[model samples]
Target: MSKKKKAKDIMPLLKDEPITEKHIGILEENLQKVPGAGKKGIEKALETLRKLKGAKKDETVNWQTYRNEELKFEFKYPKELDKQFISVVSESWPSWPPKMTIGIDATETDFMCEENPNYKDESGYGERERVKINNAIYCVTSTSGAAAGTKYVNYTYLTIKNSKFITLTFVLSYPNCSNFGEDNKLKKCEAEQKAFDPNKLADQILSTFKFISQ
Candidate 1:
């Protein structure tokens, strides 16, 4: 809406013709009406404008940190996520609910084959691959199941930090709301589920996890 404000102290200036958020929308809508070179410059300016406003679409800058002092690890999460939605368990075989949870498991077990790392319910089922997060290599697993018109998606990230195994898991249960045999309620629930992506949010949260020195 105005010139970008600097983090440092500076003098403010008045504008002869101020641009508003509505003007941005109008420009975006009519971008195709402009010629090729003109359109490119306008697009670049819009990108800079968005950066100056310190805003990104569908992204949150304010995040809360979760630290485990004894385990020597920490991660961040968006403040909009209720703390009640997260849990941590430190056990040999940690069980996960159909929700968000992070775990540090340092179990002494030989059941898992070193080559595959498949361990009963703890390991991911379908798509398994290696991914690098925060400069650390992690194995990712994707598992899915469905029951009674509801679908469950489980994404698990596993890695070893400081000789201890760590897991960052996100489970999404779609259309969890009970429709009670009503068409309108079912439609509303399905619409909500289709509008949001669980995996993208999982990636954002999982990337914040980092191991600290003991």
Candidate 2:
């Protein structure tokens, strides 16, 4: 008699097999056998599987390189994503240092959030986390919230090189536009809930970031 397959056995197949509803059905069946596996457990497992698949897909994506000679740094972004450079001016300090802003535009299904002026403190708008790339450490501050009826999520990476600050930001914004008023709000919330994961792409791009030493 053949033995029953476990989630571990099935998980390895995901690397080569295309993920489909059938694959999820198989995972759901095996997830039940996991100790303490509840609704949350199943959801978490599914999320992990999706992200893994996404990373795999990103492996085949064509990426373009962006190099800054003066800053002595470079990074890669998807060829399809738009890149923008902007300068911020401070009112209080005449000697306000120069900073560069890189914005990644959103797709039809996802929204990119821009920087918000109303956020007085970091805690009020975003959370801070640390990430390492190419043996270098960076501080990333991120936030997800709604503004002017539009939903937005953003991540900002900060690092210092040669006594100057280097910042890279990624923003996702979704516009809430529907004629149904409250129903529109509900739909927007639901859309946000179902939006594509942004962190995966962000990580893909950031992984290629490296500081070129002069």
Candidate 3:
């Protein structure tokens, strides 16, 4: 008599097959049910599925890539983000075109990112936190202020890459998320702001940044 087809038996058949998050979820749900060798096989497949998910996300975005051969670094960003040069505009003075950018500077700065006593204003450089992104840990310094009643924000991502200390700076300026009168009537701000959120975009781009040589 032949044995029943188990998950381990089906895993080999999944080779080169496109797996979705739903498929991954199902596998994770059943992972505990299987024991021994079958369990190990599913665990390995789950890891592959997760990597495939990340690859699929990158493919769907079709973001533009920026590579600096001299620095051996590369990153990607969306087209909507590319056109950003907008500062919150007003009637008295038109806001200048958005100048969204990820400015980078490589220096031998301190790795600890210690706060300077001279910098009395806590808001100037709020706090330093260590975060891991793109397989590299960075000392992130975030600062924010208001300009003409608009929110002005900056992020400094400092890390050491290829034996050189590097800093990636990101800036964002956006008016408060509100609905004054889109259709001539007051309404609440839309709950979804993912499409235009610069901060979210910055994090996405940061994930794509890496040293090609490494």
Candidate 4:
């Protein structure tokens, strides 16, 4: 007997398919119906779609490449990190992007990274002073041309260890989940999982990270 097909199974068949600008317009219209999905939120979704469309071939990899429960996925990184940090992320949520991506960027002297002290807590959660590291995290998701609408939950974190700047950003995202009314709650659920905390989202950010980059 054959096994039943799952959404995951269908994803790959459609992965390479591109989304059109007209499709993105549909997303913008649907997003307006959801509460709090203002101009900025709609723009965010559109931007994510653009990024996904702009993704090049070499920068792409599969979940199986980095396979592990916490580290069961492959991705493109624009920076180099200590072996330990890389391992931590790989083992923490390797397949986080699932069929999508978790964009990461690391550089030195980014205006944002330099202000660690301001974002840090009294207990020094973010950065003690200035470890001199910068990083960004993002994801791309779309349902359909070159640019499909998308939703991503991202974070920027900085950690300086062993005389090296270690900045790590990981994401859990859903692409092409923007058509709230057209599609089911898949996108909303994905967004909630990444953006909302178990209790209250505001509480989570304040309690855990102390700052919300998004």
Work out how many backbone clashes candidate 3 has: 4
**Model 3 TM-score on a 0 to 1 scale:** 0.48
TM-score of each prediction: 0.44, 0.41, 0.48, 0.22
lDDT of 3 by residue, 92-197 (tens): 3322222223334454454566654333244464556676654666666666666654566566666665555655665556555443446422222233333455
For candidate 2, give the lDDT of residue 190: 55
Steric clashes per prediction: 0, 8, 4, 14
Sorted on TM-score, best first, the list reads 3, 1, 2, 4
* lDDT tens digits by residue: candidate 4, 37-149: 24454556566666776764432222123222442332333232222111112333352322222224434333232343334322223222322212322111111111245
Query: Can you write out model 1's per-residue Cα lDDT over 53-135, one digit (the tens) per residue?
Result: 45433353467677777756677666443322222222322423213334555443411323344433543345666665546
Report how far off residue 109 is in candidate 1 (Å): 25
Off by over 4 Å in 2: 1-61, 79-124, 129-138, 143-148, 159-166, 177-195, 212-214
Q: Could you tell me which 10 consecutive residues in candidate 2 have the lowest summed lDDT?
A: 83-92
CA lDDT of each candidate? Answer: 0.52, 0.53, 0.56, 0.35
Name the lDDT of candidate 1.
0.52
Candidate 3, residue 97: Cα displacement in angstroms equals 13
Q: What is model 1's C-alpha RMSD?
A: 11.2
lDDT of 2 by residue, 1-214 (tens): 1113333344566668777767677667756665653445455657767777566444524676778897567777654433121112234222122224433432323322334444435423766666556564566666766666655555566655334455666555545545235775656555654654445555566666677889
